[model samples]
Target: MSFRFLPDDPVASIKLRPGQTVMVDPSARRGGSCLEVLEGVARVYCPCEETEGMTLAFLQEGDQVRTDRLCSEGICVEALTPLSFRSDAEPQEGVGFDSVNEWTLQLLRIRHLGNAELRLHALLALLVNRLGRRCGQWCDLPFRITHDRIGELIGSTRVTSTRLISKLRNSDQLDTPSGDNNLRLSAALIESAPVLG
Candidate 1:
């Protein structure tokens, strides 16, 4: 079942309970490797050259990342939910890399080049498009995203992200259902952000 994410490829799968973390360090001597989240959400953090520090990229079920060459710095992936994952030493073929790479690149571009508001908007739209599940006219973003995580995604301070989120809520662009960590994004809000469409 877990091997479905890396179909037709030799792989090893493991289960990670919530809050577990795995380090992926590829070496030429051991060949390349790929990591795929078969279930649950995982946060992948890598060293960012531009930021001169670390940056986070969140992955949901069916998403995978790989390094064909040696990873000098390596990547740290932490499970946000009870996660099933796999690691492959043999080169992967036909895996879902295009969408994952595009998504990562787009966020990096926004983080590096976009204004605070634009970055915030782009990140929200991305969440809706990538991790959201449709619920009526709203899309449910099933994550407990703190202002700090939002700030990390947008390259801003937590205060700034809090202000933006407050503004969004006041403007009726974002909403949270009572007693749930999941966020509900209005369809109108999704349409308004060009990044989301």
Candidate 2:
């Protein structure tokens, strides 16, 4: 849960190791400044005292998070993989898409599902579709998220998420091998997610 404050000076780029978090203070930047991911993946989350660590979005290479539109307290970006991003990007014209907003909307939708299992399934499908890639027979997510974080994402308790994850493992739908940082999900499991239908 430890995090460092983003430097107020405008730097060309910043890099972070996996699990490192830096808080972005919108008030410290220009009106339309943005951060453009140069490489790797990051989990963007709330930094406000009330909602600290609540993930708002996941950004990967080429994705951008607009500072002007963030909460007054700004947000925190946690390196999910070896991450690098430009800190002094100008706002692009005519690109109405906001990765944070889109992810927030989708996450909200998943939370509204009736059952925790459904929510977990939908969450996996969404993550795989948005941030993972198909391998020979499984979809591989570049980074691993903890069960507690998964529970937070799906609006469930950690114990419930662990139970559901165990079920998936027993069914051969999920694989997290020791010594590997990736999460391998069966293609069938991703395809069968009701949220994707």
TM-score to true structure, per model: 0.77, 0.96
Model 1 RMSD in Å is: 5.7
Model 1 TM: 0.77
Global lDDT for candidate 1? 0.68
In the range 124-166, model 1's lDDT, one tens digit per residue, is 8777777787777787887667788788788999999999999
Best by TM-score: 2
lDDT of each: 0.68, 0.91
- Tens-digit lDDT string for candidate 2 (1-197): 68998898777889999999999988898877889999999999997778747999999988999888988988999999999998888867887778889999999999989999999999999999999999978999999999999999999999999999999999999999899999999999998887633
